[model samples]
Structures are given as structure tokens and as C-alpha cells.
Target: MSARISNNLRSAKAVAAALSDSEDERLSENSNDGSVFLVSNDEDSEIEKVKGEDVITEYEDDDEFDLETEPASKQRRLNKGADRQSCRGSRSSGNPNFSTNTKNDDMDVETPVEAFRVLFDDAILDKIIIHTNEEIERVMCLLISKEHQCQSIHKKIDKEELCAYLGLCFYSAYFKENESCVKDMWDDVFGRGIYRATLSGKRFEFLNRVLRFDDKNTRSERRATDKLAPIREIWDIFIQNCTNNFEPANNCTIDEQHKPEIIMSYNCYKGATDTFGEKSHEFSTARRTARWPLRFFYNMLDQSAVNARVAYNLNADNPRLSRKKFLKKLAFGLVEPHLRRRLGIATIRASIKKIIRKLLEIDEHVPAVVSVIKENTRSKCHLCDSNAVGRTRMKCPNCLRRMCDDHRTAICVECSAAN
Candidate 1:
């Protein structure tokens, strides 16, 4: 480059450095309204330029003159800690200047990972530097808002939005130890969304008794293997269905309306863990106590807890866990030891029916039930109960008899299609 042009760029760079400080002052000085902060050797000219109708447009074309994309010169003293002192100059540090120590701390503690933590923090700082104290507090609260634990806490945002934010945190911190901690605390306090997030995180340790590749050790290994299959199968269904509407980029924003059963399952899993401690025995006891399917006791406990959580909105309840203790006992059966031997199929079915009824309130299993009900109510011919509904002849495919719509294989479309 020519020396004159280079010199001009150097001079511009120097002015830019000075302008950073001026920028903050300008932002503060015009706090109620916004004004552009311009840097130029001719102050009057720059001010006049800013006032012109096409000022931003004129400057837009000359972005190379802007400081951001420009190449740094040897004369520039940009380094750590430069922005700390200046009122308006650019902060020398990059976004996420959080120290290595902070990264390690976040990792160890399972703090949530946000997509734009650095950007968000920077924006908050910028707002603070410019806004009134009240606005600063309001913006900070928005940035750090968490899911409501109780009604007395004065809600400012919807629960689903809160869940999405929490989900973002969980999703961002995937595979981190702190993620597990966050999941645990979230489950303990909030419940429903945590199970879905945990299961999605695929950090099996966060899921109580739902054994994964890592949990296979000693007797615990065999037990976890035995307990894990059904839960895993259920999760496979849950994930496939729940994720149908969510692309990876937008996974955090699950609507409360979609995949109700999956949501129920997530809540149930969370509730079970909260009721039962993280250890295997507590899970085992809770499973038996809840009177869930004993063969897959641990799996049922995990799934059930999630269901209960989502269904009840336990996190937002006035008195959290009030129903938890009773539900656990009722589901598991705190009947005297002698009563266990005398318990019949009817009793077991009744317990299951009760759980199912409660689950319906949350509508978590509505999708699954609706799918089943639709399959059950399809049109079919009547001559024999073995014909496909749409067939022109209306003859039974299996029985080969003439049939009408009324009795043509009451088995319905799903069964016929399966055949």
C-alpha cells in the first residue's frame, strides 16, 4: 500500500481507539434517546455528517474506514485490560473473556451452556453502562431468569418459555459434569422438562437407574442391563416422537402442546427420581413402594416420576412435593407385609388405572391413546371381520367372505395395514 494511504489508515486507527472511549460517553450522554458516535479529525464535520439524512448510508459504504474489519498496525496497543479503564473506548477483550478458571468451574459445577453467553453478557454490560438503574436490573433479571418454583414468586414469564430457557442451558452444557448437576437440581426443583433434557442429553448417569453404557459394573451392571432395556425402549419412542417437530438448532423451544405423552414421561422420570434418591436402593424401594411393574421396577420408577412431574406442574405448585410423598406410597404400595402376599391382579390393575387417570390430566399420553383410538375406530366391511376397509369388493382378505362397512374386520386400519 502507498505510504499516504497507510498513514491515513494509521491515523484512522488511532482515532478509532480514541473513539471507543467517546462511544461509551456518547451512549451515556444520550441515555434517553440514541445518537451515533462518530470519530473524525474534523469534529465539526463529523457532527454535521451525523446530522445529515444520509449520514449512516454514507458511512455504510466506507466500512473499511470502520475500525472492526481493519488490519491492526504495530502502533496499536490492543491487549487484555485496555477497555477496563476507558469510559467509551472499546473493551480490548473479546466476548467470553471468562478466564480458563471460569470455564473449569462451569464445567465442574454443571452450569448451563448458553449459545451466546458472551454476547448476552456483553449486551447486558452495554445496557448497564447506558440504562437507568431500574432498566439495568430488569435486563439482568431477564438474562438470569429461571423456572418458577412456586406461585408466590410473582411470575413475569410463562412456564414453557422458562422451560425453553432451562432447556437451552441444559442442551448447551451437554456432556459436562455440571450438566448432570444442573439436571439434578432442575429435576429436584422443576421436574418435567429435566427428564426430557436428561434423556436427550444421553448422560445416563443423570437418569436414575436407567442404566447406560457407563453404568455396567459388577452386580449393578447386570441389574442396570436388566432394568435399562424397557426404559431405553420407552425413551427411544419418546425421543423419536418428541423430536419430530424440533430441529437440532431449535430443540430447546418445545411447545407444551406437542408430544404430551413424551412430556408426561419426562415429568414422571423426574418425579420418580425426586421421590426416590439417586442411589439404586432408593430407586428400588420407590419402585416397589409405587407398586409399578416389578420386573422392570427401576425403569417404571424412572418413567413414572417423569410422568408425575409433567402432569402436575410440580415445579409451579404452591406447595411442592405435597403430593409426591403420598403418590410414591400409593403407586408403590405401603400395604403391610402380609397384605402383599394377599394382593390380587385386581388390586394391581386398580393402582395402574389410578396412575393412568392422573396421567391423563397432564395429557402426556393423549397422543398415544389418540393414535390407538383412531386405529380402533376405522371403517371396515361387515360380512367377515377380516377385510381391509378400502377394498372395492369388500371381501375379507383373510376369511374371503362378502362384507359390509359395519363388520368388515373390526380390527381396523392399523391391524389391516400391519397384515
Candidate 2:
């Protein structure tokens, strides 16, 4: 989602800082779980100033803002060593020395469902199956009622029936516009008993409430200005998970990838508008608004499928494999190399923790590395190769002094020009 969002917007840097900041929050959340950062063997890891963002936010409106896995065995040991070396190198020399791999590593590719199934127990999965069944049946009933001009009788939707129904919907998507809607799918063709259970929207709502793992009192406290002392516990967990995933970013290169804002905002704006309202910022608002809803939850589950594959690939027998190169190759191949989402940083972090912890709970046998790195190192400037800032550093819109300072409080050329 983040990758897609970046494609829509003209400026990707706009959210880089947002991501960086939330990275800390997410990392901190995992401190106790041994899932994010490997507890530093060294007591002092030097904190560098924030740097590398191309441009600061142009949003004068203050509303812009924001927001892991593990692997295993022989490969995991290498990552741990690499992580320790990277950290110590950063502290002593103020530079990043991170993952360096050859080209022969094995690749683990997942078929979506295989990876996601680890996160849910039979009970949770059953609940999902049940809810999905209800959802499909409800839509079918509505369609039937409208067509027949009478109150359609509700029916019980089972897993096999839903699967048959979905198989058609999946194929139907290629139709002129879309053939996935429940109404469009109800026929004698897909399967005879697939949708025997169809209920009206009202009836479904009455039978089962919205599925949520968080407390009813749970809500974001970030909007508060007065150094809000209390925030939800879930948010903490989410941040730690993110830090774990984001930890490997020892240095960020200033590659001239297409205009992130233009690419992402234009393409993803419609999605954000569709998901939230047009009024929300494409990444920030849309992501926060969606949070751990079933759709996002599904996406998180889907992401695990990819990560598990990556972990497997890393652990593959090829000792000569290059992890970074392998990831880049995989990026172009069948699976996504990163957990890219275009939502607010915080919300996305929460979604990750949700997926990871659930998996950890259900599949305790799964290694923590599948969802997060052993630890993260500070990012160094691609040019200077110096230890860079901790979170996000600003680039001058005026002068070229882009490597050393915090511009969050001070005004930039936009303000200077006005003066």
C-alpha cells in the first residue's frame, strides 16, 4: 500500500520523515518482545541527526501527519552478525555497514494463503470464514430480493460455498467493468449450494457484530497537543513491529526515482478518496482511518505470506546468496520485497503488530525473524557515507546544506520568501 501510495504522489519524501518518526514508535513497542531490535550488546549506540529527506512538507496545514518480522537458522545468524557489525560501525565511525550479500541465495516464494494462514488460529480463521460467508450471503440475498420482488429467505453460507462463489468473482473481475459484486455472482453456475446462506444486511448485522480485536475504548490520542501522557497499548505494539521491519535501513540512497507525490498522489488519491473521503490526505488520513479493518487486516495477512517466503529464501541452502540483491530481484519477481502501505505511519504500524502478534500467538513455531529484522542500523548518506540522522532530516529548499539540521520548527525558503 505504501509503495502504491508513493506511486500516486509527486513527492515520496513528504512521507519519508513520517515513516522515520513512526519507525521509532514501532521499534520501541517491540523492545520487550525480542522481535524488533536485538537488545544492544553495546550500551551506547550513537544517535545521528535526521537527514536524507529531499524536501520538507509543503502542507502549511498542521494536519499532515503520521504514524516487523523475523527469519531463521544459518541465515538468521548471519543477519545477527551483520546487524551487530552495522551497529558498532555506526557508533565508532558514524557510518553504516549493513547487509552485503552475493547473488546466489535461495528464494522463498509464497502463494499468498500459505503465508497468511500462520497468523490465525482455527477459531479466528473460522470466525473470518463465518463473517465472510455472512457477508457474501447478505449480498446474495439482497440481490435475490431485488430480482424476485419478494423477501428472499436467508440461508447458511459455508466455506466451500463461499470459495465457489469467490472463484467466480475472481474470474468475473476481468469482465468489462467488474463482475465481483455479490449480485453479479449469484447464478446457478458457479456452484449449486455455494450460496445457500444469504441474509439481508440488517439481519447479518443483528446476528454478528463487527469483528475487532481492540477494545471499544481504543482510539488515537495523537491529535492531542498537551503532551498527552496516556495512549493506547496497541499503538505501542504496532510501533515496535515497524521498527523491526525498518531496522535494516542503514543508509538511504537519494536515487532520482520518479516524483513520489505525483506518482503516488495522483494514482492513489482516488483510492484514498474511495477509502476515506476526498478531504483526507492520501497517505496519512486514509491509512489512519482504515487502521486494522478487515481489508487492511487481510492485506497484513497477505504481507506475511511474502515475508515468510523472504525468510525462507534467506535461509535457503545457497550460502553465496545476496540478501539485498535477492530482495531487489524478488521485488521485480512474483512477491513484493517490502511491506509498502500508503496509509498513516502509525496506523500501518498497528496493522503490522496485529498481523505479527497474531501469527506469533497462533504459530509459535514460526520464528520472529519472519516478521522483523534482528536489529536496525542508522541510515548513512549515500554520498558522504556518514552516520545520518536518527529519524528524518530536512533538505534546504533554499541553500544546499541538506546534510545537517532539523527544520521541523524553523521556516524554510517558503517562509523566507514571504519575509
Candidate 3:
């Protein structure tokens, strides 16, 4: 506010601008609020007062003083084609300062929506649609016959609409997989309010019947053991076909860019990605819960990822697919011919008596050993110290006392209750 104070500040700045080039190289940079600062070389008294430290004014100054800061009265001549010799830079005009460019050419410029659209190539989508409709019909018959209540429920899903529904489910769930339920996914796909309209179909029906398989005809001893036989076949076809089509990177290493399945470190460096910050929780959350009823979700989550990869990989495989024009006859193209070996079951279990006898023999008529707790070795009983009997075989944990097998009880109430 005052001329004298302002003069002092300017004098300090001039001195700092002078001394900045000579400080310890490894020391932290002089910075304030992220802006680079400099050291002051004001008069010894002023420097000490301003910085609250001893001022070592005897050290030599550096050439960077004038190289960086110039006095207002004495203007610096710009780097015009030099007339005199200098060591700081090449004086020739041909040696123009070449600043580095910040933009990356490798980054994908496609929008998420556009990238997503590329995944559902028309033919693969058609195959998916047909496969889906067939599943719906087959499931519908089972529901109607076994569940008489299904007589009241009726719906027909065509290929086009079913495909769209599946796409929407993926689009919504991919973004919010960790935090939201399937219903939340639907709400996101449709819109966010009581007044919002959505696709006209049965939500309950879709959830219950989507990709479910039920078969009761087989009575073989060993069949591929589970429900969802038909759906699993479809899933296998999709994974196999997509895997066959993919081309891995020429020089890309898995542990570098792609995360490893075998976890060696929890705290380790992860590579950069565009969505790294926003979707940051995915990796940590994935690591935290690696088991449980997440089997359904584990597959779905992978599908969401592979959907993106399918887009990117196909892009890299041939730029033509990514750019414009069509891929040659895209199709689900599932060939459903599979061979299986059937094992026979014995039909000679004529009486329940023989079955019971076989089960008892298998068990050897002994109840299983539920648990065993070992004890420390000891030479004598804690109670009687009897050498006449076998050496002490166990110890009392609480009191650190030894006991022979003759004196050993299954559990000592006193010792068991103690801490």
C-alpha cells in the first residue's frame, strides 16, 4: 500500500530472482501455491529479517540471474539471430526452440456410445436374438407345465426387442456394476423418475426366465450336472467364437497393462487408463470379494468387460471394422453338435435293506472324527505324577501342567473355562 513497502518487496524479488540458480540441487524447489519461487539476495539485514535465518551473502552468484529475470529499465534482447558468441544456446536461427507436443495419438477418440454400438454387429446380434427367443419359448413351456400359476402370465418376445433389452442391460450395468442391483440397471437404462416410461414388457418375467434352462428327461448317472444346460451351451459358443476371433497385442505384456489373475501384491502399481479415476473402485472391489454367491455377477461382469474388449480388439484386428463399412458376414453362427458319454447306473437296488447295509459298510460302522486337538509332550501326570503308568501324553494349556493318558480326561472343565 505504501511506496516504501512496495520498494522493499520489489527489491526482495529482484534479489530472489538473482539467487535462485545456486541453491542445493536436491533440495525442494522454492514454491508457493504450486507457482515456482526464488531465493532473496536482498541486503544481509533485510534478508535475515525477511527469512528469519542467517544470511550467507559471501557465496558466488550464477549466470542464470540475467538468463531468467531482467530489470524493467534494462530490457532483454530476444533470441534474435545472435550477433555475438554465447555458451547458453545455439545462436543460429536454424536451431529454433522445439517444444514437445502434449497430445497423444494412441488414445481412442470414439465416444462410449459409439464404441458400444460397434459391439452388436448386426449378424451377431441377430444370432443372439434368435437364441434368446428360442430360450424364452423353451422356458415358457416348462413354466406352464410345472407351474400352473403361469397360465395367468403371457408374453411373446421377438428377436429385435429382446436384443435391444439385452444391450440396454449391459450398457447400464457396465457403468454401475459394483454398487447397483439389476433393477437399478434397468432404471438407469430407462430413465430416472416415477413418470418416466420404459420398454413395455414383463420385468419379473425377464428376470425369472432370461437364459434359464430346465430339463427333466435325462435319467443318466452322470450328465453335465446343473440347470441351464441350453443357456450354458449358448454361453460356451459365444466365448469360444469370440476368443477365436481375438488377436492379442504384438508386444503387449499381460502383467504390465492387463491385471494378472494370480495376485502377488495388493499394493502395487496399476497402469493408467482414461477411466482410471472415475471407475477406480473396480479393481479393489474385485479383489475384496473373490468368492460367494457372486458367480452370476462374475460372469456378467466379465461379459461387460469383454464387450468393450470385443469392440477394441475387433477395432485393432482390422481398422476397417472400426472405421467404416461392414465386417464379412458377422454371425453368432453356433454349431450345436456336441458328443457326450453316458455312464450307466445299477438297477439292482431292489430293497432299501441292501442300500442301508452298503452305506453302513462304506462308513465302517464308525462315526467320523469331528476334530482333534494335539497337546504338548509330558513325562508324568500333573495330578498323581505316576511313573507306574505310561508317560504323560498331554498338557493342560491353562496351567502348563503335564498329564498321563491314564489321568487324562477328554476335557478338564476348569482348564477349558480359563483364559
Candidate 4:
């Protein structure tokens, strides 16, 4: 019984040996195939061994592998040597031709408003004005009730008022009062007086409500395919302006995650955006509204203010300008032209006239002395009705034209009070 058991154990050992020899032979035969088996080894040795195996498999069917009978290590060394020699041959000392054609840097931009205008020019303003007026008219047409019609009787916004509205928006941002209630902002006791002086609270609220970037009638059609249909036209214009005005450096990268601190400091793109968000949040002109377009408009204004600062700083010759002062100047500059236009109306108060003149740097018109000419030389008043033929010896010194007493009196009042 012991001999039989010993014989079975010996047979089992022989069968295992035979199976091991067959596996080794199969592995050797399939070695040329592109199959890799991982084995336990030192980290560096494993890496090198895998790399060596990869190189051998890649060139297995090549003429180079057929001609070379070297060991795997010798082959790897030869490949490394060849790679080094190829790199040396391909290396060049010549510098790459890279240049920036940024128009903002080359521009003669001096003020914050001028820089702001680079992004939001008259064309954009005109577009806003047109759309805003269209929106107002549309709302007015929809008002069938007498009470609603009376409430909607506000005049359509013009270029000047639009500018003033934008200026006020910037002013709100500068003062960090955007989130404040309109009543609080316009309060005589605690509010900044400029808000009241620049625009009526009701007028501002009306402008904000009707301010449109695009035509509402056509928006639905465009919205079917465009996610940004509401502000697409304005956004396109802004993007084109940015592309024309600014050019990024070649070394700039836009990676938001795992960025090196040094790279973040050098690249203004991310820094500017972050600063814009921070500063805008501190003084955002956006109110909590259901309309996303208005929020986007507020964001555009914020970005414009930030971009304007960068543009303003491009000129080193300018005085050190703070953001508040910069925004004040920018806002005033935008509203000044419209204010001057309003001065032409006769109904404006004398005190308001003097203020407007001072702000516009206009030399007040001197009161023209009415001089009498010889009766023979007197002609019909230039401003009088042709049928009336009111001949006057009195002549307006400013226009150097003959005027009747009625026209002359009106001119005298305007000239005297303009100062």
C-alpha cells in the first residue's frame, strides 16, 4: 500500500513538470506577439523593462529589428542614443516671430470715459437707445386702459437720457449703492444729492424697466436656435470691439485649475475677471429682477468699468486716478453732451443754465446791446412774420440781424440769465 501511494505521488509530480515545460514553450512561442504580462520587480526596473518590451514589440516586424540580433538592454540603449542624436540634429537657436497688435496700447486714450467708450461706443449706445424706445412704444401700445395710458405717457428715451441713465448706473456702482432702494438713494436727508440732481427716481425706474438690448418682437424667433438671443447683437458688438482693441500675449494660458501662483500674477485675464467680479459684487448695479437681460447688461457695465480702468492705466502720463473718481468723470463725460443739448430749451431755470454752462466750460454769452440804426436803413425783422413786415432799427449784436421788439426781448432774457 505504501509503494502504490509513492508511485501515484511520483506520477503526479511528473505530470506537473510536463505541464510547466509546455507552458514555458507556449510563452516563448507567443513572446513575439504584442501581449505583455506584468511581473514583480523593482519600480525603476519594471518601468525600464516595460519600455524595452514596448520598443521591441513596435519594431518586431521592421527591417531594423530583423537585422539587429542584440539583447533587449543593448537595443534600448541604442534607441536612447539614436533619440538623443535626433534631438540634437533637430534643435535650433532661432527665435520665433511673435508680435502683439493691441490697438488700445497704441491709442491716444486719456480718460476713463474714453477707455470705456472703446468698448461701449456711440454705435452701441445708439443701438440701446433704439431698442429701448421700441420697447417703450410697444408697452405704450399695449396700454388700453386710460389709467395705464396716463402712466405710460413718459417720453421715449433719447441718446442723452440713455447716456445719463448709463452714467447713473456707473455712479451707483461707484458708490456701492446699486442694491439700495430708489427712495433711499433719492432721499434728501441721507442719499447722495447727485442721484436726485442727475435723474428723477421715477424716470430712472421707468428707464430701467424698458431698457432693451434687442427687439422683443423678433427675439422669440431667434431664441428657438440661440440661447443668448436676447443680448446676441450687443454681445457680438462688444466681442468684436474687444478683439479689435486688445490682443493677448503668446505666453498667456487660460487654465483655471492647478494654475501656478506666478502664472496667475502675470496673466491679467483671470486676475481682471476675478477683480471685476469682486468689485462689481461690492457695487453691482443689478437688482433682483426676473429679467436676465438686465442682469447681463449690469454685468456688461461692470466689465466695461474694469476694462476702462486697464485702458486708462495704459497711459502713464495721466494723473493717479482712483476708481471712484474715474467713474465720476466717466459718468459726467457721458452725460455732459446731453446736458448741453438740454440747455437750448427756453424753459430751463436760470440757475440750472449757469450750472450747465459751468460744467460744459462754455463762456457765458454776453447780453447783446440793442442799438438803433437809421430809420432809412431799418429792414424787416429776421424773426418776424413776412406779412407783419415789422421793420426795426434794433439789431441783435450776437446774430448781427435786425429783430423786432418781441424777438429782441426774448433773446435778451436768455443771454442775461445764461451766466
Best candidate (score: TM-score) = 4
Ranking by lDDT: 4, 3, 2, 1
Candidate 3 wrongly placed segments (more than 4 Å): 1-153, 174-196, 213-232, 250-419
Better of 2 and 3 by lDDT: 3
TM-score of 4: 0.57
- Provide the global lDDT of candidate 4 against the true structure: 0.66
Candidate 4 lDDT by residue in tens digits, 309-381: 7677657788868777787788888777767676786765665666677777888766665554434576888
What are the C-alpha RMSDs, in order, of all predicted structures? 27.1, 35.1, 30.8, 18.8
lDDT of 3 by residue, 1-419 (tens): 23343354454445455545755321233532223223344433221122312221211122122223455213433331131223113312223231111122342414333333333335445544555456566667887788755531335544444433443343333333334444553453553321012232244236334433222244132246744443444445555544444444322233344432312221122221223333323321121133322234334333434344335433344443421111111110110000000001132121222332332333323333322334655466668734466565566654556765555555333223220
The estimated TM-scores of all candidates read: 0.17, 0.25, 0.31, 0.57
Task: Please give, for residues 1-419, the per-residue lDDT of candidate 1 as tens digits.
Answer: 23343454444444444444565432222333333434455433322223332213322323333333445422233421232234112212422221112212222211111211211233332322232233334434654676423231222322222223323332322222222343453453454332332222223221222212211224255555575532343334444432332122211113333342243123222322333333322223221222232234334333333333323332232234333342333232211221222222243333333333343332322211112122223344454446454533455555555455555335443333222
Off by over 4 Å in 4: 1-101, 104-106, 144-153, 251-273, 343-419
Q: Please list the C-alpha lDDT of all candidates, in the order they appear.
A: 0.32, 0.32, 0.35, 0.66
Q: Between 1 and 2, whose lDDT is larger? A: 2
